[model samples]
Structures are given as structure tokens and as C-alpha cells.
Target: MTDERLIADLHNRWVFGWERNAGDDPFDFRRVFGEFYDFDSPDVRLYDDFDPEQRVATTAAGYGSIWEPGFREMISAHHVVDDGPHVVADLGLAASTLVFVARITLPDATTDIRTTSSLVWRRTPDGWRIVREHNSTKVLPAGALDHRLPARRIT
Candidate 1:
């Protein structure tokens, strides 16, 4: 498969995992995200706007833990890829960037968040594994999410 398609598929898989446990509020976040990252890498970096400390997660479980609390009360969700899964590949390494918009519901309120994420992947013995990721997000104003557009919606 082409690198672009492969990366896009990987991103979609991650989103599937993200929205899969919306009904299970107190779900095992680590288990959901276990297949997405490189666990053997000693320096798997995860940079997120929510994490000001700039910590590096050596394992996929550790990366999932960072978002566990934030996703604990997610009632529903809709995630759409707004921009390109722009990809560049060289031998066993690949980099992909994706811009996505997500509308998420909690017990108290609903929020629309747009994020631009870049992921660095290594062609592992198992498959392509994410070794690094950086994400920047902005919470949009109320009514900003357009559900009419095609998206993966979990209700």
C-alpha cells in the first residue's frame, strides 16, 4: 500500500479506538491505545498542548495514560479528518501530519476541538509503529462543529 494510504489507515484505526470506549466511561484507556505506538523505543515522545511538562512516554500504555483522565467522562464523540494525512517516507521511517476536528460530549457540556498532529513512525518487525507525536489543539466556540460533514460519530 502507498505510504499516504497506510498512514491514513493508521490514523483512522487510532480514532476508532478513541471513540470505541465512549460508552464505557471508566474504560481501560491503556488497552484501547496499546496497538498504536512503539513500546520498545526508549524515547517515544508525546507532546500535547494539555501536557505542559513535556514528558516522554516510553510505552504506548504511558501515552494512553496522559489522555485517560480527559477522556474518562466522554459521553459521545465525532471525529473528522479536516486536512491531509500529508506523508513523507524514507526507507523504514515515515512522518505524517493530520488536522482533525472533534466534537465531544461530557456529562456537563459539549466541546468542539480542532487539532493538528504530526506523528513519526518506524517500520517495526510487527508493523508501522508511532515513535513520536506532537499535537496542538484549540477548543472552538459553541456551535462550531458541523455534523453534516462526513465523520466517525459515536452516540
Candidate 2:
């Protein structure tokens, strides 16, 4: 298959697997990490705008640990933004950028967060492994809380 299609599948599966677990909260780390992470890289980074101190994660385990069994599980709804996932790749590198909106239900309140993330992957012996990712999030306005997405699924 073509590289573009392959990369898209990789991203889609990684995302769908994560979102699917929102029902139970705290998605399994090993499932997606094993398939999509470059465990040997020793410098996998997950940059975020909300916390400047957490801009980069330099270890494979450290990066994976960020999403492991955390408050992210309270996600009541999640959807990939339509017309997003602007993907590009060349040589042995690929990057997929997309906007995701999720609604989180806390103990007393529910809020919507929209995050735009760019995940960078490298083609390795283990196939496509994510090496780096950067994301920025903003609290959505109360009126913009629509969770609708296109009917067809990517994966």
C-alpha cells in the first residue's frame, strides 16, 4: 500500500483506539504505545501549550506515561474535526495534524476542550512509530459544544 494510506491508517487506529476507551476512561497505554511509539528512541517528546514545563518528554516511558491512567478518561465525547488531519510525509518521516474536540465530565462540571495536535512519526523496522507530538488546547465556548463528526470512519 502507499505510504500516505499507511500513515493515515496508523494515525486513525491510534486515535480510534484511544477515543474508544473514553467510555471506561484511562485507555490502556500498552496497546497503542506498543504499536505507535518508538520505544527505543529514548527521546520521545510530547509538547503541549497549556503547560510550558511539559513541553517535551525525552524518554519513551515518560512520554507514554503522560496519557496513562489519568484525568483524560473523563472524556464523555470526542470527535475528529472534519477537513482536518492535514498529513504529509517524505523519506522516512511522517506528520499528521488534526483537530480533536472532546467533552470532559468532571465531578461537578463538564467542559469542552479543543486541541490541535501534530504527531510526528518515523518509519523504522517496527513500522511507523511516533517520535514526537505537539498540541495546543483551548476551552471551547459554551455555545460551540457541538460534538458532531462526519458519518464515515477513517479506520
Candidate 3:
């Protein structure tokens, strides 16, 4: 009904699809990508699990390589904090922050990655298209990626 509700729903749908898309047998990346990405333009960008120190762009052929075969299956359990809409002055654009506490199950370990992502949304003729997404993750200690989740702090 409201703008906030719609945005939150979109985000949640993406997360759900991501969790269900990949499996031990084969990774259904097409299904997962179809749910949220805009494949029509080269303007799309996803800073996936990125650290500012290292550059990993999940764009173009890079996406295919990142989710290639032999990669371990991952399960994502996330809760989003909706911060509502923030519009850019005079620009037909708005943005919001979806704070995610994601417990990601890797092949060897499960880590709670506290991520705060800012989604830059624009009202397109088709609907609200995410023009950009910048994700930042909380720093964790070495060997702290297990299920224990001890002394986990959110930044």
C-alpha cells in the first residue's frame, strides 16, 4: 500500500529467491537473477559481498564466474530493517537502507554477516528499478565464521 511496504516486499522477495535458487545438485542462477536484476542495461551493478580493499564486480561475465559450478551451496536467512524513502532533490530518484542480518551457511561454516545496504531506486515506467546497490559488511575476526557467532557485533 505504502512506498515503504512495497520496497520492503521487493527486497524480501529477492532474498527468498536467492535462498531457494541455488542447490547442491545445480545452481539455478537464472531463476535467482530474474527475480530482481535489470538485465536490459549495462548500468546495473551489484557490489556482492565486497570489501572496499578488494574489487569483485558481479557484472556481465563476472556474474557467471562468481556463481560457477563447484562453488559450495549457501543458505541465506536474513531480516531487513526498512528505513523508508529518501528522495534526491529535483531528481526523479529515491533511496533507502535495508539493514540485513544475514546468517549465511557456507560449505564449511555458517557466519552471521551484518550488512547494511543502500538501495538507490528510481521510479521507472516499468516500475521501481534498483539503479544501484552499495553493500557494507561488518568486520569479523579470523576463524569467527562458525555457527557459534560469539561476540558478534553489528556496526
Candidate 4:
């Protein structure tokens, strides 16, 4: 398969796993997070919903804290690659935009959040790994997420 296809496939797989995990009783944090990121690379960075302004250096282990347990989360995700997997020497670069609606069910109340993320992937010896990520999220006022778009879903 072509590099672009491979990268797209990888992105879809990760999204599927994320949705699957969200529905699981005991979410498998390591299975998805550990395999998807380049922990060995000291350059990995995250500018996610937690702190959008700060470009925090992150690792596979660090993700455990961010995805904490307590509330149950269910997400419907869509991924779109707007540009190329422009190969630069030994590195392959692909930029993707992901939109996901997460339903968080707590003991008292449930809230739905819509998040848009931009990710920069780097091809590594292991496979494609996320090198940089930025996310923006907002609480949905109403309505369920539309699943009509061509995207990966678990439920």
C-alpha cells in the first residue's frame, strides 16, 4: 500500500480503538496510547484540551493521567487529511484534522463535548507516530453527533 493509504488506515484504526475503549467497562489505556505514540522521541508534544496555550512535552505514560477514570466516555470521531504525506528526506509528514463528539456520563449528570484536533504525524521505524497535536473543545449545547459522514464507529 502507498504511504498515504497506510497513514489513513493507521489514523482510522486509532479512532476505532478509541471509540471501542470509551465503551469498554475498564478502558485499555495502554493498548491504544502505547501503540499510537512515539514515546522514544523526546520531541513529542501536545497542545490539547487540557491546556491549549501550553505546548507540553508528553509521553505515553503521561497520557494515562489525562485520560483518567471515573466518568464513562463515548466518542463518535471523524478524521480528515486535508494535505499530503509530503516526504522530506527520511521523514514522512502528514497533517490531519479530527472532529469527535464525546458523551461523558457521570453519576450525577451527562455532558456532550465536541472537539476538533489537528495532528502532525511522523513516520518512524516502528510505524507512523504522532509528533505534535493540538485540540480545541467545547461543550455541546444540544443534539447528538451526526454519524452520516464516512468515519469509524463502534456503537
Maximum-TM-score candidate: 1
What lDDT would candidate 4 get against the real structure?
0.57
Poorest lDDT segment (10 consecutive residues) of candidate 4: 80-89
Kindly provide the TM-score of model 2 when superposed on the true structure, using C-alpha atoms: 0.77
Cα lDDT tens digits for candidate 1, 13-49: 7755766335565757657666778877887887778
Indicate the residue-level lDDT of 138 in model 2.
93
Distance from true location, Cα of 124 in model 2, Å: 1.0
Against the true structure, what is every candidate's RMSD?
3.4, 5.2, 6.1, 5.5
List the pairs of residues colliding in candidate 2: none
- Among the numbered candidates, top lDDT falls to 1
TM-score of every prediction relative to native: 0.83, 0.77, 0.62, 0.67
Reference-based TM-score, model 4: 0.67
Ranking by TM-score: 1, 2, 4, 3
Question: Model 4, range 1-155, lDDT digits (tens) per residue?
Answer: 76666665666565556553334566656765676777787877766664433446577556544664531343433333333323222347776665656654443444556667676788778878878777787876543433323333334
Least accurate stretch of 10 residues (summed lDDT) in model 1? 146-155
Enumerate clash totals for all models, in the order shown.
0, 0, 0, 0
